[model samples]
Target chain A: MQIMVNGTTHEVDVEEDMPLLWVLRDELGITGPKYGCGIAQCGACTVHVDGVAVRSCQLAAGDVDGEVTTIEGLGTPDALHAVQEAWIEHQVAQCGYCQSGQIMAAASFLETNPEPTDDDIDRAMSANLCRCGTYPRIREAVRSAATKLMEA
Target chain B: MKAKTLAVAALIAATATTWAAGETATTTAETEAPSVSVADGLEAWSRIYEVASHPRCSNCHVGESGIPMWSGPSYGKTRPHGMNIAAGESRIGAEFVTCATCHTRSTQGNTVAHAAPRVDMDWQLAPAQADWFGRTSQEICSQLRDPERNGGRTAQDIAEHLDHDLILHWAWDPGGGREPAPYSLQEHIADVMAWGMAGMPCPNG
Candidate 1:
């Protein structure tokens, strides 16, 4: 099947039930989305499907009809996304294993809710779990990212 | 309330007598004839109980809160559905992030272990009336037979639902390390159809 990932359409051969996570990491060699709890329980494998954050581990490569975006596609290294900038500003990464998923989820959440209250952030980011418990920093980073996006 | 309870008791007694007579007649009927007695229906219900109590079915058939549960042998711990997910009153998570935001139709055949299992339908929690978590088999049987609780489905409708609903089929296709519900889908469907045809009796009722 042909899937557009990070703005590049690649024809890949894999089973219809193969998760997009493996397709990204093993097949395409895109490793931003980590494997935390292979099940959807953990948000470590979050990615964007048509601008909405979804667990890549749960999503099938064949089921992806939308444009795919991973952390690598979120922004160039030279010009970081607002969320990335705020993540750096807040020093959100502790172990950094879940930061990519967190950042992806936050970016999607902010797209729909550019100015979110604490509750909104909680509801949106609740799916993503960080074992390091960087939740306070995550909230602060989201706030900062929202402000930057609004300004930009 | 006392009078209502007494009336219900009397009706059950009357039905029991009639059902006993029906069973006797069914015993002498043609071999092809279906056994349509309350006892047979309740017997079929025992099988349904096995399927319903399984994590694949019970996890999504939650209570009034509309929060799906995650428990049983596969999860290793019984708890609320992960990701702090909530379906709200919509039962489809529309009040928040919809289930389809992650669970899509038609997953790949070779999905990794512990990966989110996918099916070919829009995934959502069962309605409040169909809530089965922490319920006894008798209670679940009563609820399934109750028109109000079972979506006003008639016995035939219930059979059709069991035979066809793709989401319900997920019980047998639960990928990853999750165990499928007891019995094959075909056997479960047969039992469900028989129970419906036999008057959908509850063991306690």
Candidate 2:
């Protein structure tokens, strides 16, 4: 099957039921999307499928109907996505293991809700779990990201 | 049970003879079959309720909550499905994460332990209108008979839905460590057809 990840289409031989996360990390070696919980419970494997946020860990490779954009594909070193910039400004990362997924989720969320309220940020970001308890900063970053996206 | 079967056979024979005689068919089967009493229909309904109310079936047949449940002996206590999942308005989780994300549609049975269960049909919560979780026998019986609440399906339509719906079949043959619903799928459908034939009598009625 052909899977486009990080702006590059890759032809891969894998089971259809294989999670898109595995296809990204193992098959294509795009490790931006981390696998926290194999189930859709944890948002650590969150990615953008045609600009909509989806848990890649739960999405089967065969079922991927759109182009996938992971944290790596979100922005470049020269020009980071608004969410990435906001993350740095808010100092959202403590351990940084779940940051990529967090950034991806926020980026995707801001696309649809460019002017989200604090409550909206909380509701959306709460989907992704962080053991270090960086939710306060995460919310701040999402708020900041929303502002940046509006300006841009 | 044997007596009921014989009575039903006799009723069928009588009905067949009545039709063959070419006497203008006037009354419905409900009026004609005195031997197949309302008691028999209610008894069959009890069995149908048994399968419908089982956790395997009712867990996903949630009401306005939109939160499917996870129950039976395996889970220790009856509780909502994990991950704070909601089927939302779509009833397929299109708003947040789709049920298909884990419960992939496949003809093959659930093989992995502690993973989401799957059937050939697309995994989804039963319509809010068809909510059966925590309902009484009378409430469910009336709801099933009422065309308004029952998706406007007649008795035959209900029987056909039961026969063709793979998710209902999954209740009886749910692979994995989960306990299957009380009776076989055929038995449940047969009960439904019998109860429907007898005017779908409620316990109190």
List candidate 2 stretches off by more than 4 Å: A48-54, A60-66, A77-86, A105-125, A143-152, B1-36, B105-108, B119-122, B163-166
lDDT, model 2, position B62: 90
Model 2 misses residue B9 by how many Å? 14
Q: What would the per-residue lDDT of candidate 1 be over residues B32-129, giving only the tens digit for each residue?
A: 44555677667778888988888889999998788888798977889987777877778877555567666765634324565555676778888888
Output the worst ten-in-a-row residue range by lDDT, candidate 1 chain B: B20-29
Question: What DockQ does each listed candidate score?
Answer: 0.37, 0.15
Model 1 lDDT tens row, A1-152: 99999999999999876889999999999999999887777789989998888888888777887899999999998999999999999999999999999999899878867888886687778888989999999999999998999998
Output the number of the TM-score-best candidate.
2
The CA lDDT at A54 in model 1 is 82
Fraction of true inter-chain Cα contacts (below 8 Å) kept per model? 0.56, 0.05
lDDT (Cα atoms) of all candidates against the true structure: 0.76, 0.75
How far in Å is the alpha carbon of A140 misplaced in model 1? 3.0
